[model samples]
Target chain A: MEKTWIANLLPQDEYREKRLLYFIAEAVFILGVSLFLYLMVESFIVEMDMPGDRMALLCIGFLITYTTLRSTLTGIEYPDVASEKRYQKEKRLRIYSTIHFWIIFLFISILFKGIPSNLEETFDIGGSATFAAIFFFILNYLSLKKSYKKNKDLLDD
Target chain B: MSLNNDRKIRNRIAVLRAEWNLSQKQLAEELGVSRQTIHSLEKNKYNPSLKLAFEISLFFGVALQEVFQYEEEEA
Candidate 1:
């Protein structure tokens, strides 16, 4: 009866396996984000005039926010309660930072009364904020990437 | 880094459970593990945690060495 009881409840093995799968998912997610960043830089930022660059920057910022939110909302089936909590905390921090970037980006893009006619002067104002947003998003993305790698290594054992 | 022993300690966990007159569902309930876990262990496809090992030993009233063995490391 006792043996029969035990046979019906296998907790440890299942949890370990779930942890492994979660790590795999996290790695794939981070790599996907990195690839998207590469694509964004290549296609949108490399060779554009001031207004075009600003528009491209805004689109990229929105893209980052959208992807981060989607991933956070769907990360629940991630092994165990402990892992889920850690993921949520990291996701929450990333969300906060990215939102801060979004607000700053929006303010600059929208609040400026007009684009300066002089190309260099316009770039001084517009380019700085655009670059700042890019840096912020990169940092947040790297944080997620690092967390995914660290957890993946731990779970592999 | 790896298991040093060549001799494998085989088990008949399912057979033993039957001889002791227990069902998979009943053992699963008592051990706080899933029936799938028991099935995996019985099939030698999964390793149990130390806690589970101790519990199983206690339930069977046998030293853990009786259920699991370590062949002396090859010199």
Candidate 2:
């Protein structure tokens, strides 16, 4: 019966509002941690040798991954409705499958094409990976929007 | 709640919960769903699947029809 801090923070009655708040809170928390890590890496590990652009890319990649993972895992749920939940789960699976397919395809292609043999090529591979990550994150966001539209009736306030 | 075409399923979960002396949290726990889900069900803001519908009926020891009423609009 005792409410945890998170439970207390979340809206009790409004499902949509609660989910939105939770997502924002999660994003902020992740971004904050990523910023902290970036600072640590720049100060300690990489020191002065690490380029600013590379550091920025690392932070961006972490944020994208965190957002995508959260969206994929915490799907739109009409928890009382098993079918809706199942539908959402299937949609999430499809999105994840698409993402996995692209990542694997990229990996295999890069492998067959041979590992980036130079610093420039290595940066190219990193850039490709970052682009792919952003693409999938956008795909997930769009998918979530589509699903929301489909089930708008069920999610009425 | 509005009796619009959008509201396909109407339920008496709130009344039943009251009759059963259970809070939304308690019923949600019993039904293995979130408290918000129970609230949504009571407010007729969500429609449960056949499986969840049956589960709810079973829990209440009532027929499915007793728990929910379907109001299909004329085409």
Which digits, one per residue and each the tens of the lDDT, describe model 2 over residues A42-146?
788886566879977876777666655554455443333324566667667766766786678579759876788899987787677667766765666565655
Among these predicted structures, which one has the highest DockQ?
Answer: 2
Task: List model 1 lDDT by residue over A46-101, tens digit each.
Answer: 94344767756765666655554443333322222224567667767776877788
Residue B55, candidate 1: C-alpha displacement in angstroms: 0.3
The models' CA-based lDDT, in order, is 0.58, 0.67
Of the candidates shown, which would achieve the greatest lDDT relative to the real structure? 2
lDDT of 2 by residue, B1-75 (tens): 765764377888988988999877678788776665676778777677577789899999999999998877435
Which regions in candidate 1 have their CA more than 4 angstroms from the true location? Answer: A1-157, B5-9, B71-75
Task: Give the C-alpha miss distance for residue B3 in model 2, angstroms.
Answer: 16
DockQ of each: 0.08, 0.09
| Lowest-sum lDDT 10-residue window in model 2 chain A | A74-83
